[model samples]
Target chain A: MVPQEHPLEQLLRSDRMPHIWCPGCGLGTDLGCYLRALSGMDLDKVAFVSGIGCSGRAAGYVAVDSFHVTHGRGIPFAIGLKVANPELTVTVWGGDGDIFAIGGNHFIHAARRNIELNVICINNAIYGMTGGQVAPSTPLRAKTTTTPYGNYEHPFNFSYMAAASGATYVARWTTAHTKELTKSMREALEWKGFSFIEVISMCPTTFGRRNGFADGLEMLKDMKARSEVKNFPDLEDTDIGEKIVVGKFVEKEKRSYLEEVKQWR
Target chain B: MSMKSWQNQRGFLFLKEERCKGCGFCIDLCPKKVLRQSEVMNAKGYHPPELYDVEGCIMCDICTEICPDFAIYRYRSKERGKNA
Candidate 1:
């Protein structure tokens, strides 16, 4: 009966068998890292919120008080829960477009206010769910459905943005770095102030086939070969071409918005 | 590599064949090269991997973690007696 059950059967929504992610997608791997971080923790104290995108489906699959919120609105919803019950570990998972494009304002304000929340952005470069449209995180000269001639606009450096917005904890990791990613997630889960993790996962279906990768494995191998770890990654060099830099860019102990508000009252 | 030897190394390594999408992440990334793509197709028309090697399999469970489809899982033998 080796095929009887999955190891994370208790952690996942087994009734919703066979997730919707395409074959060779990296979203599954990212979810696996999140699940590993959830291990040895009280599930009742967790509340997962996800915005619209391929990564958005993540909220529905986890066996927790998960919320599949509106586009780019995951942060606000998570904030509502955290404010109402500060004890819950509120997390928002979204794609590059969902987090950086539509939810950009909320993200910046939340970070600036130093909210006690964990924000995970899985940047696949383009909008994978909507046919690989050019996104704010897409690298310069990268091709997408809307930017077939290559994107001329410069891309946003997510780690740099999070740090500049006053996030206490910011880190960047690719899907290939599983152990490191899981470790980063665990740290963020335990941290007090605003924390952001940007994961460079693969989108072989739309972003890959058009960009030259034959499959997710090839993209993962390329990421493994191209990625360089740096504790102090140069923010200016994060364009996702030539080579990729991955590591913890900024981490500091700071008072969260809730703590400050309570003191002011 | 024989089945007996593979079993000796692994207390339990499960795969939900129907859930596999044949992405080959587990097989390609396996540290020990213990698995290969099975020729048969499942209900989803994807070729799930099968264990073929008996040597060098550390039973690291990397496949279980790396599998995007969540098709692979492992249980440690009672002799080793660590948590799954």
Candidate 2:
């Protein structure tokens, strides 16, 4: 008989098992992929940071050096950590609202500056941790706690924003695409400049009940059905929709912020 | 390949019952019909998965990758099959 321990025990704070995430939420799936991608790397060199949200709990679950920082400050804090010790492979994991709304400026600037960091944004459509408020990335006209009548604001196309902001590497995949997500995450980590990966996760407890999705598995199956893989797809055509375009939209070589800064010195 | 042939080189499944939140990802996504939700519930009153057909498991690790909770995994067994 094989040892009964979970394979990921070494990478998890096992005492904290049975996490606070809802039963059908996608955060755990995304975190599993993230951990799989980090395999074979020196654990000491990886620095994980997360902002306040349901997805932010990923940092606490991970066994690596992680920071569960203030709301919307994950990117800036990660950038500081990278600058202080460029040797450390820094990554920021946050929800869509935390990344594209409150930390919007920091995200664009970090990408524009070509910071060496991997950003994983879990896009579950609503502000789940805050009880399903209409988030900046929530689909237009979606019902939420705050948007009882429906939301009027348009959501950000995460991959397009990252590509436009000058991120050297960008990709988007749903939580169901575990293998592809893992591969993309590995590539993002390997890339020397700014990298962003948007994972469309399902928030069944808060976001799903309000939306058409009856449960998480249904949402996951729907997400899988909607996804059309198009490697190096046109950024404009990669918006989330009935038939979502999922793939790596951008990959280019660029001098990192540290590299450029060092050249001036 | 036949079922016996596949069974010869199968994986040993492991479950963390206490940690499972009964998401059903592993049971639903298992390529082989080897995992099922337990009739008995955990301390949290949720049904976790149990190995239903150990021989049918292929060690794909899809369950491990797809589980929202870190509740299930298929550990590689040392016994190698004579007929590959």
TM-score of model 1 vs. true structure: 0.94
Clashing pairs in 2: none
What would the per-residue lDDT of candidate 2 be over residues B1-84, giving only the tens digit for each residue?
Answer: 000111335556666677788888888888887778879777888888877666677788898899888877766665455442
Model 2's CAPRI class is medium
Q: Where is model 2 more than 4 Å wrong at Cα?
A: B1-9, B78-84
Writing each residue's lDDT as its tens digit, candidate 2 over A1-265 gives 4466776778889888779898889999999899989988999999999999888898899999999999899999998999889899999999998998899999999999999999999999988887889888888888999989998988889889999999999999999999999999999988899999999989998888888888888889888999999999878887776788998889998888999989998
lDDT of 1 by residue, B1-84 (tens): 011113644566667787788999999999888899999888889988888764456667798888887777776564445644
Top-DockQ candidate index: 2
Q: Give each prediction's root-mean-square deviation over alpha carbons.
A: 3.2, 4.0
How far in Å is the alpha carbon of A134 misplaced in model 1? 0.6
State the lDDT of candidate 1 residue by residue for A1-265, as single tens digits: 3434666778899777689999889999999899989888899999999999999999889998999999999999999999999999999999999999999999999999999999999999989888888899887887889888988998898888999999999999999999999999999999899999999999999988988899999999998899999886667776567788898888998889999999988
Q: Which runs of model 1 end up more than 4 angstroms from their true locations?
A: A1-4, B1-6, B78-84
Best by lDDT: 1
Chain A TM-scores for all candidates read 0.96, 0.98
